[model samples]
Target: MTWPVVHISRSLDHDVAAVSSVAGNPANLPAWAAGLSSGIRQEDGRWITDSPMGVVEVAFTGPVELGILDHDVTVPDGSVVRNSFRVVANDQGTEAIFTLFRRDGMSEADFQSDADAVRSDLDRLAVLLDKCLLRTR
Candidate 1:
């Protein structure tokens, strides 16, 4: 069965290249993506972070230069959660989009909370990019 999906997005006053450069980098997760992680470190070519659940690995895939920020999160049990993320050009700026899938057995309330958190993370990312606008663009 297909899971319910929601696309969370935020528009930034920066180019797609700029957005991709910062957002696609896992090292910058603590700076903006608080919902996903507080801090991330590279170990053996893998992005490792401690989540509320436990230690997890974030492996970003696809061409980041093309604004494709797709990634997979490996949990403690070794199961992987695939995330569809991207940044697209919007006028002179860019719009970052994160696709969240409602997992099996997930509650409606919990799913909504996840969506809310994603929105907040995107907003934080936009604010961060705004601060570094001159350097990025």
Candidate 2:
């Protein structure tokens, strides 16, 4: 069965490169990604963190210069989730879009909750970038 994909986005008052520089870095995940804010550490070339569900391993694959922030999360049960995120230049500022694929067996309510979480995380990211931009100016 094919899962449905949901696109969530947020506009940030910064350039694409600046947004990508922070979002694309695994080390910065805890700073903006609420779900992973507890903490993350690298072990054996994999990023590991403890989620509410359990321990998860994350693998990121994308080009920072191109603003591609795709990553895969391996749950403790061995299931893998793919997250597609990107930073694009908009007329007024930069837009960060995240594509979330609903996992198999996920209920409608669960999917909605997941989307909300992603939105919140993006909001946090925008705030972080805004603060950084202010500091440089």
Candidate 3:
């Protein structure tokens, strides 16, 4: 499977305590994530949202439980593309990687567009972190 990745990282001027607090809070998903309006409650403890692209749901499955947000988009010819948003924290800071993929043949133009969209979304994340996650203290 071919998956294109777009990654972004920034170090907040605050300590890990503040950064971790925001990273660990699932309720703040929509605050930063583009296309995501609100996170709905589900039975399995995953946050759900009706994103700009489609209906997306995120779950924490790993030790850090980096929330996974995914939704599928359909092309006119009945092909499907999967879009995913992943958020994780490291010594540097919180990192977000968005990927786009297709099961069948997909054009390079489509892939580039998809990657650009993800990059724009991450751009919003940078603003969100500055405003909501990291505050002057």
Candidate 4:
């Protein structure tokens, strides 16, 4: 199944090309995406992240997998969560739609928390792009 996602961000620099460049590049995800540990793999049209939340695998235009590990204190084992991101140009900035698909038995509260994390990431992205452009000039 698929889930509806929506997010909007505006950049002060107004450099559409630069904004687009950063958004499309999966390698740049860790630079701006909050709670992301590292960008591990970038091959065969996929980007992998060693995320604190889980092992996140993101396709260039497919889907993202967020593994929910089994720890005694929290979530149980054998649970896998999937997500996706759709980026589009909006005025001078960009709008990112994050789609979330989860396994059965998961709670809506978890999904809502995930949405909040995306909001934090978007804020980071704006600062990242601004820093990037400043360094180039």
- The 0-to-1 C-alpha lDDT of every candidate, in the order given, reads 0.88, 0.88, 0.53, 0.54
For each candidate, give its TM-score against the true structure: 0.94, 0.91, 0.54, 0.60
| Candidate order, TM-score descending | 1, 2, 4, 3
Estimate, for each residue in 1-137, the C-alpha lDDT of model 3 and write its tens digit: 55444443443443344544554455765665555545545546646556555555564433334344444434334455455545555555555555555334667887677567656656665676678744554
Could you give me the TM-score of model 1 versus the true structure?
A: 0.94
Tell me the spans in candidate 3 whose CA falls farther than 4 Å from its real position: 1-24, 42-44, 51-56, 65-103
Report the C-alpha lDDT of model 4 over 16-63, residue by residue, as the tens digit: 456656655667767876655365566675555665666556544322
Write the residue-wise lDDT of candidate 1 on 1-137 in tens digits.
Answer: 89999999888888888888888888888888874557888899899999998999998896998999999989999999999999999999988999999999999999999999899989889887877776644
Worst 10 residues of 3 by lDDT: 60-69
For each candidate in turn, give its C-alpha RMSD to the true structure in angstroms.
1.3, 1.5, 5.4, 7.8
TM-score of 3: 0.54
Q: How close to the true structure is residue 101 of candidate 3, measured as C-alpha lDDT? A: 57
Query: RMSD in Å for candidate 2, one decimal?
Result: 1.5
